[model samples]
Target: MGGMARYDALLVVSFGGPEKPEDVMPFLENVVRGRGVPRERLLEVEAHYQGVGGVSPINQQCRDLITALRPEVDLPIYWGNRNWHPFLADTLQKMAADGVTRAAAFITAAYSSYSSCRQYLDDIAQARAKVPGAPEIVRLRHYFDHPGFIAAMIDHTREALDRLPEEDRDHARLVFTAHSIPVSMAASSGPSGGAYEAQLRAAASLVAGDRPWDLVWQSRSGPPQVPWLEPDVCDHLATLHAAGTEAVVLVPIGFVSDHMEVVYDLDTEAAGVARDLGMRLTRAATAGTHPRFVSMVRELLEEPEPLPCAATCCPAPRPRGAS
Candidate 1:
């Protein structure tokens, strides 16, 4: 393994989704394990998961991704879920059993937030505690600024815009979205600061430069006492309608695939609001298995060595499994 020696294997880690109805609450409960979201809140979230029959689209997307990415890398690629089956800890155990000495992991999320970025690092840290001679983990550098990814998103955004009615295309307010987290979690998000919004804006700019778009947050959730991002999509849509904004185009630039967030939040929740507002809306396609996306991950895994991380480069904010 020459250049392939960056690691003995490559792991594509992602937020796991429940594949059946009964697993919904348990899966969501795992996600909010440390957050202490009440049973009512968990049930509310589970309600959405159940609406779609409890199957998350992430596993299927990961399956296709692993398939397409095989030719790009020589080592075996393993799929692990952050909150579900073939879990991070279990996957690490299996890799150790399979005699993997050193491995590189690329969490599917492409941000610098606590849960989004460093927690994956923390996951590897926590998992290694129990395993002997665990592979030297090389967390891939963030690629939000990568050219191939930006190009893929750009092309996809243009294509999504084309689907809108002719009259609305020009007037469509461009909306970029990602998963929402507590403001407290967001407070210490960056090795620097505010990289979450910056990376998203950079990605969105690559696709929407001079195209007239507004960056508003979506899917903000909390304990009803604490605050999250304001003017959520529903509020934004109403205000836009009041301003006579007739059409809109949504780009889920924050995500790589049509996970539950897109399917449930946008398709079911936001889409319904737009329909009621009499505003035409279309969402950019999630970059599930785009060639550029696949190639980018391949390039990352193929790098001769890991880039030296600074003291602040994606350091974990809270201890993994701390909750």
Candidate 2:
């Protein structure tokens, strides 16, 4: 019989990015390592870093998390980056060596789509093979609807609204932004059929009940022939500006940590678009090191649940030519 282990130490997993300009393309390559992303396209991703003093905010976010979590839990908490330093293999090797008996993981993403959830498990399993004595690993379920997280988002958006000129606050449209996906995947992707978008919308609804808000996609990449969710943030902003909307508050619900998407896409690309359109814009902060978020992790660790799986989970069609 296979051995069983109790959940002790906690591992917070994230999609890591490069900390310096020189490391950017190599990091992007790690992201799509197996699939061939053209060198030129990877450079475009690197350019996002160039706009922000050549640093990804991910490492700082991880650092804040480690400090916040150190005191509350009995077992050690370690962070492993999927594509960069403090890499998963090294983190797991150290955990095993440190006598970590069992572990529960909290992926930085709040939803359960394939890339967001399952691929993370694949990373852990691969890391375990290289690091002997890995304890039984269990991942915390996605927290899109967790009360405290949702409440944190609500308060953040409300505060962003307060930042606008008092007169414009009422006129400002609440725009919820998340990383984009190819339309082909959206047709069937998510934990249950279309659950990914639904959960996000639901969370947004909690924040903007009677207020005007629209969910839009950002950071699309694929062949020109491929369709992604629309209207893209730029297009959406332009339309709103043309319609005479003056102020906007962007809430990035898809990401749990403040990463490049929040920085580059919302802060840089999205902000630039809004400026050209003559629209005033501000972004709600990503829920980084929020007390509620730490509490959510503590709750999950004290009493755990498996990620949700249904017949429709990962509804993407099986790839062609696979038996």
Candidate 3:
């Protein structure tokens, strides 16, 4: 419980997004660098950012989360992003200059996977390697099924359910969604393998409770020939409609904030799919600045330090076309 004794600061690590049209492509390039993502795919994703004024909600959401966390946590809070301004290396440099010797990192991502868990750790390690005297950064434990997180999600899902027509509310199917990764990544995630999907299903089950629910994937990228998790949200929506499911609530349990994926993929693309199918749909908000969720940060900090993941855990995928 002596968080202050163990760490001098709290570092917020998040997936960054572009703040302007011109920054979109560059940011996307940083995201897919060395990953063999086609330029065409980058351009396609770029348009999604442009459609919303070329601003990603992620950066602003990070700012908002830090703002909310400031009052609850006693230590100085710093933020860093993986692929945009306020990059991780720069943030660590600042932390070093401020005399911060050690810090606890609260990554925006909650689950275990190559991208979600290990990649962020790798980013921190890489960033620290670049900064002289960079503070020792320890990541908070995964909170996919933490009570605070589940409570916030349940409340939001209920709010979304209430938004439906009274007649449809009772029959609305609960559909939990997360970002999709390649099948190889999913299979190899975490220490023993398959931890990514298992953790997600656990969180979804907790959030769904006694309600009938289904887990689906969203925001898939990369070549079509490569396999990723499925059925995709839009595709799943169509199937539900065909099965006479007239209404549904989408709980984006995979994301922590209403970033581009939540706003664009679920709200824009998936919403369109439901509209076309004449199915009622409402999306539960992510746990952005939710009071309970905000308090969870302090709770994580107070807990005993977590064990670091093994090197083999969530190993980075080989680049596309790599033998």
Candidate 4:
């Protein structure tokens, strides 16, 4: 195991997505369970999935990542999702059956937030509780700022910029985006608070370097009465168009792959907005199976074990209608 002596296996954890039209609603229900999301809203999001033939690219991306990591690490790599098939509990059952005692978990999310960080840990804990003899699954540290991740983004950003018209390339603004969480959840993220935005800003800065850039949010899914992150990607594109910005490169730094959000939100919705405004736009690819990114997994695995999150870090949001 080399430096991974404390762990017997590496498990890839991700936010699951539906594989077919029939599976869409059920998969979405699992995602929004107990969050009080309106069925109307669920159907609206469901349409986004159906429009793309009801398949989410996330699960396949996870498989590709696992395949890339196999040659880099010696441990048996297992895959599991929080909401869809190959559920965490089932994966844990298999792990236990195989006599795997302890494993290191690498979540697809790279930042700190309730949904991105703590909720995953909570999910793992809950799954372990349900499966007898579940291995001690320790999540790897947040790698939003890791050099390997940054390098991958930088390379992809360059590629996206190249796709723009030659005249627009030099003047194109870089707009980095991520999923937006509710305001209260964002405020309570990480050990102290605001770590979600803080970490994202740090990563965005590293990716943008000296380029003119702005960080925005996308794919917000909460009641209108509540506020999540502001200046959504599409809205920002409109604003940039109005401000006479001719072209932009959208860097989805918040996501690890071209999942549904990246495909529907940025590639579809945001692209439509840009088209309406007659502004040039192209989206930078996520860090999906990039060589440097694949190597990063092994690096994280070989590093010294990470300390557990503080009890209050990235605290979950109180359920809707709570006192």
Off by over 4 Å in 4: none
Off by over 4 Å in 1: 1-3, 308-323
Off by over 4 Å in 2: 1-5, 307-312, 315-323
Model 1, TM vs. native: 0.92
lDDT at 87, model 2 = 94
- Per-model TM against the reference: 0.92, 0.91, 0.98, 0.98
User: In candidate 2, what are the lDDT values of residues 72-154, reduced to their tens digit?
Assistant: 66667889989999899899888888888678887888875666766777788899898879766788777888877887788
Clash pairs of candidate 2? none
Instruction: Give per-candidate clash totals.
Output: 0, 0, 0, 0
Q: Which pairs of residues collide in model 3?
A: none
lDDT of each residue in 1-323, candidate 4, tens digit only: 44788889999999989999999999999999888788999999999999989999999999999999999988999998999988999999999999999999999999999999888999999999999999999899999999999999999999999999999998899999999999899899888899999999999999999889999999888888888899899889988988999999999999999999999999899999999999989999999999999999999988888899999898889867779
Quote the lDDT for 108 in model 2. Answer: 88
Native-to-model Cα distance after best TM-score fit, residue 136 in candidate 1, in Å: 1.4
Per-candidate RMSD, Å: 2.8, 3.1, 1.0, 1.0
| 73-180: candidate 1 lDDT, tens digit per residue | 788888778788878878888888899987888778887787787777777778787677677778887887777677778878888779998877776888877777
- Residue by residue across 1-323, what tens digits does model 3's lDDT show? 46657999999999999998999999998998887787888888999999989999999999999999989999999999999989999999999999999999999999989899999999999999999999999999999989999899989999999999999988899999999999999999988999899999999999888989999999998778889999999999999998999999999999999999899999999999999999999999999999999999999998999999889999999876779
